[model samples]
Target: MDVPALLDWFDETARDLPWRAAGTTGWGVLVSEVMLQQTPVARVAPIWQEWMARWPKPSDLAAATQGEVLRAWGKLGYPRRALRLHAAASAIADDHGDVVPADVDTLLGLPGVGAYTARAVAAFAYGQRCPVVDTNVRRVVARAVHGAGDAGPPSTTKDMADVAALLPEDAAAAAKASAALMELGAVVCVARGPRCADCPVFDGCAWQRNGRPAYAGPAKAVQKFAGTDRQVRGLLLDVLRDTDEPATKARLDRVWSDAGQRDRCLDSLLVDGLVEQTPDGRFALPGEHGAVSPRG
Candidate 1:
């Protein structure tokens, strides 16, 4: 790979994301990584800015109630991630001296910090030369290195090794290269209608050299949002999130028509510790149902 060429392209074309700002801390990078999971960057930016301002450090977030964290998370979808992030904040504050750990292993120990997230924080936040393999990075590697039209099923061991090999020896340069590869996949070597004309490594791209064959790998599952249990859960959570007071079962019923599904979703929410039943049998976000007063 033409590492210098790719880095130059990234230097000129990388998105000016707030998380990439010089002043962003490890906590800021961690929050951005979590928020960016399966969520668009545009939607994450404003929310990330709000979160950074409201909870600049893990301790600040640790001090907040889970209910407050969920409310701040808004409609990011996967409300469970919000809960996990809150848990991580508590761990970081209490166990890690209120600091987002720099090492991948220590980062993985944090709640909800997976392989991709751990490496991302290590490379992007700490400028360590760790492999940060996300979907985009995988795609870029599959095409550029392996000559595959698209990345097949994820193999953590192989994927990490592939990216690790591509990284420059210098830690800072490797970090920049990781970011550059991700940006290239996101913007130029995109899954659909790739703008190969703008690709920095076009001449040397294995997939391009092979005439850009179509992806013939295993079919990927298409996720549906409408009418799924996830949608129902989001609807139920929406009702609780919009209100400061507890919602009656009857009030929650209005969101979904199927009594069984609604009840099941509600039960799941309660089991997940996302919602709590008040002494009066009303549903409220965690920390809002007990002795704690609702935030203004």
Candidate 2:
């Protein structure tokens, strides 16, 4: 594989993501990694930019309350990730002295950080010889290398080896190649429909030669939200997130109709650390500049 050529192509053609730019601080990289999890690049861009602008360092974020973090997170969904990121910032400040750890193990130890996130920080932030495999990277490797139409749900070891084998010898170059492959997969080798005509690895792609095969495995179940507990949770959190002070149960009750389901959702939020019960028995976002009763 012409690893250098691929990286060279990446250098020229890769999306100019704010987090991937020259001199992006490690904190910025960590924020981008968390926000990009299951979220699209376009959606992440402005939010990520706002985050980095507001809290340029881990210590800055550590100084913020969980309410601030979740509010900043907005409607990106999976609000637990915002809480985890806030916890991770505190860990970085207290343990690592506010520096994002370059070691994969240390990165993995951070709250909500996982396999792909660890390798991303190691390879992208530190320029280490680590394989950074997200969904996009997996799809590219599956089609271009193995001729598979799509990757099965993540099985880490095998996928890591496959990506490691493609990396160049030089650590920095290998990291750059990892980013290139991920970019190529995300933009040109996309699932559902691929733009093979624009692919950099088209000449050597195995799936292109064999003709793209249709995925036949069991499709994962999709979540429904119209009248589910999740929608109720969202309604409750939305009111809490927008408030300057803790909201009364009366205000929260207005968002969802069923009192039983609404109370259940509120309890769940308390358990999730997304909300807290105030001293006055009202509910507010966790750390929302007001006192709250400790969780049971």
Candidate 3:
């Protein structure tokens, strides 16, 4: 695949996200990577801007309490990510002098950072020429390069190698190519309703040459949130997060009517440390007041 040409396409068409602006810190890139996971870019932008304005560095974020973290997370969904981000910030402050680590292995050791994120931070944050593959990138690669309509389940090693092979020898060019791959997937080579007419690689694309066959490997399940445990859990958490003091069990019960389901969701939240149980049986978010300063 003519990666340099696609990078040229990106230079013209790339979305002007704040994190993509010149001089954005590694911490900004890290936060954007985390928030953009399974969440839309439009939804994450304002929140990311506000978050960066408030907590510009890992040390600033590490000083916030768990309760504060979750409350600030708002309706992003999957609130555990807030906890994970908090924990990662704590690690960065404590272990790395509050500077976000540039190496992929070091990033992998941080809480909740996986292979994709580590590589993303290395490539995007540090210009380290690492491959950064997301679901979008996988689909783009599968269809364009391999002639498959869509990727099956992700294989980290294979995805990394495939994307890495397309990178330029130059580090800065490689980072731009990584972003190009992702940007191509995001705006042009979308999963549903891809704008093939606008795709820059149409001439050489394997899928285009092969007549764009339908994905027949395995049916992907469409995610539904209504009337599910996840919905119930979100509701239960909302009740606790809205209040400062612990709420009575009876108060929490009002959000969802099904006795067993509500109890199950609440129990999960309590178990996951998103919700805390008082000795008096009231529920609240964890209430620690102070944070330990990182070593100089």
Candidate 4:
């Protein structure tokens, strides 16, 4: 697969992301992985830097109120991830001596740490030789090895095995290779408008050999945020975040026109623990119901 060529290209062209910089701890890598999920790198980088500066260690983050974390999270969308990360930080502080776990199995035990996240932390942060498959890696593998245009519905077992086989035997090299493959898929072998001419392994690509056929697998669902419950939820949270005091029901209602939908979204936020209702029936971010000054 022209592994050397690919690695060399990565060595020269990899983005200067802060999380990948020298001396970044496992905690930093964990945070980057979580923030990068379904979010763009451009959006996550600044927030991640802010998070690292504010909460340098798991213990530091664990000590913060949920309101502080959510406020720090800003408009990263998927606010639940912030709460999950807070939960993970608390668990790390209480159980793991404030150190992010290096082993995949133990990492999997943390809140919101799924198989992909566990493997990513192990390989990228700890330099372990393990498969760290993501959408990019899956797409690259589908074309490079299987001659398929796109990866179909995800099968964790098969995806892990495919990537595991491609990794180098040496731990450090394998980790770098995993990162390189991900970078390749992200920038070169992208879902649309792939730049085959610039690909390091262009000569050996199976999909190119097969005439780069169109993907005929099951259609992937396109996610829409406008007019969705997610947008309404964001609006509701925005009001709570901007206010230092609990917002009244009337204030919350102003954000969305549909009373039924607004009420449902607010109720969902309360259930998710992202928002807390005060005794007076006003709503605020978690831990900010009666605080002197809300962090957000």
Candidate 5:
């Protein structure tokens, strides 16, 4: 697929991401991978920079409390990831002596490090030749190579095989190719509407030739934000994030109109280890300390 041409393009055009700096620490790569999940690069860039500057290594993050990580997470949704990342840092510090694991299997054992993240850390941080397929790369492969309108749900085995087949034998070149493919997907082969003219694969794109047929499968589920438990959780967490002290149950109740949903969301947060309750029956983010409250 003119692999050298693609790699050359990536060498010249790849965005100057901080995580991609020469000899970037493995912990920095791990942070970037987690932050980029389902989040825009524009938003991730600044936050990633701030995070690395604040905690340059896994040991640094491990020393910080979970509350500190959640607070640093800011507007990034899916706060659970922040908690998991903090846990991962702690694990790295305790088990791996604060060094990010170079092996894919070992990285996978870390909290919140999934198949994609594992491969990304191995390839990007250690310069290993591994298939690193995310949503963007999946879409690009689906349309350009398979002639499909969109990628099916992520199944690492199939996706990785397809991407690996396209890689050059040299480890360094393979990593560069992977990045090129991802770049093509992100900027040119976008999901809602692709910029075909600007795409490097336009010449060989099967979906373009087929008139971009619409998928006949069931419609993608639309996530409802209003009145959902997730919305309630967001409201509840927002109050806690803004406050220095733990919030009373009564204070949290005011955020959600439905008592049942609010209680459910709060309970879910507690179950997920994201929030802790004080003895006085106030809730705060995990790691916020207070004396045990006596029974009412």
Candidate 6:
């Protein structure tokens, strides 16, 4: 593999992400990882910047109320990630000496820190050599190494092994290469359409050499948001986020017409610790039953 060529391409084309900048703290990297899960970087950037500016460290976030955390998360899609991140911040401040742990295993112990995220933080944040395989990295490896048109069903063990084997001997170089692989997949080698001409490792790409055959596997399911419980949940949360007063049943009902589905979604949020019932039986963001949170 032309490792230097790949790294050079990355150096030239990589997005100037704040987390990737020099001197970004481990906590900053951790926040970015959690926010970026199943969410696009473009939507995550402003929220991440404001978040880092407000809660510069785990301790800073830990000191914040659950309502404050939820309010700050604001439409990042998966609101549960905000709750998990808050839990992680609490753990870091209380147990880990307010330092984001550098070890992969230790990082995995934190809330919302999965294998890919742990490896990413270890490699990108701490400059350790580790295989950081996400959907993008997995797709890049499938085409570039195995000649497959698409990655197989999520296989962490096999995917990690494939990525680790391709790592350079030098730790820093391996980290750069890992980032490059994900970047290539994200931009040039996109799933639906690959710009092979711009790919840095086009010469060694197995799928390209094999004539870019169509994937014959079963079609992946397309997620629908419109009329789903998630939409109802979002609507309910939106009502709460917009006002200091707890949302009465009639007010919350305005978002969705179906009473059963709306109630189910609200119940789920309450159970998830994202929303709570006020003494007067109105709904509000957790820990913000009557008071408005300061938004920065």
Q: Mind giving the per-residue lDDT tens digits that candidate 2 earns over 62-176?
A: 8998888899999888899998998899999999978999989889999999999989988888889989999988888888788878887777999999999999889988888
lDDT of 3 at 216: 68
* Tens digit per residue, CA lDDT, model 3, 1-296: 87878988998989999999989999999998898888999999999999899999999999988898898888888899889999999999999999999988899999889988889999998998888889888999999999988898888889988998888999999999989989999998998899999988888899988889988677878899999999999999898779877788999999999999998888788677788777666778875422222112
For residues 1-296, could you state the per-residue lDDT of candidate 4 as single tens digits? 77788889999999999999999999999999999988999999999999999999999999999999999999988989999999999999999999999988999999888988999999999999999999999999999998999999999999999998888899999999999999999999999999999999999899999999989799999988899999999999999888888888999999989999998888888888888878787888998555332222
Candidate 6 local lDDT, 1-296, one digit each (tens): 56789999999989998788888999999999999999999999999999999999999998888888988998898888998999999999999999999999999999899998999899989888999999999889888898888987878889989999999989999988888988998999898879999999999989888888777556778999999998888888988888877778888989988989988888788778778888787778887555333222
List the candidates' TM-scores in order: 0.97, 0.95, 0.94, 0.96, 0.94, 0.95
Choose the strongest candidate by TM-score: 1
Cα lDDT of candidate 4 equals: 0.91
Clashing pairs in 6: none
lDDT of 5: 0.86
Give the Cα error of residue 1 in candidate 5, in Å. Answer: 2.9
User: Which whole-number lDDT from 0 to 100 does residue 225 have in model 1?
Assistant: 85
Tens digit of per-residue lDDT, candidate 5, span 1-296: 55776777687778887778897889999999999888888888898988989999888988888888898998788899998899899999999989999999999998899999999999888889999999989988888888889987777789999999989999988888888899888877888888887666677788877888876555777889888888889899999899989989899999988888888888888888778888777888878676343222
Kindly report which residue pairs in candidate 5 clash with one another: 279-293, 280-293
Worst 10 residues of 3 by lDDT: 287-296
After superposition, the stretches of candidate 6 with alpha carbons farther than 4 Å from their true spots are: 290-296
* Better-scoring candidate (lDDT), 2 or 3: 3
- Candidate 4 all-Cα RMSD: 2.9
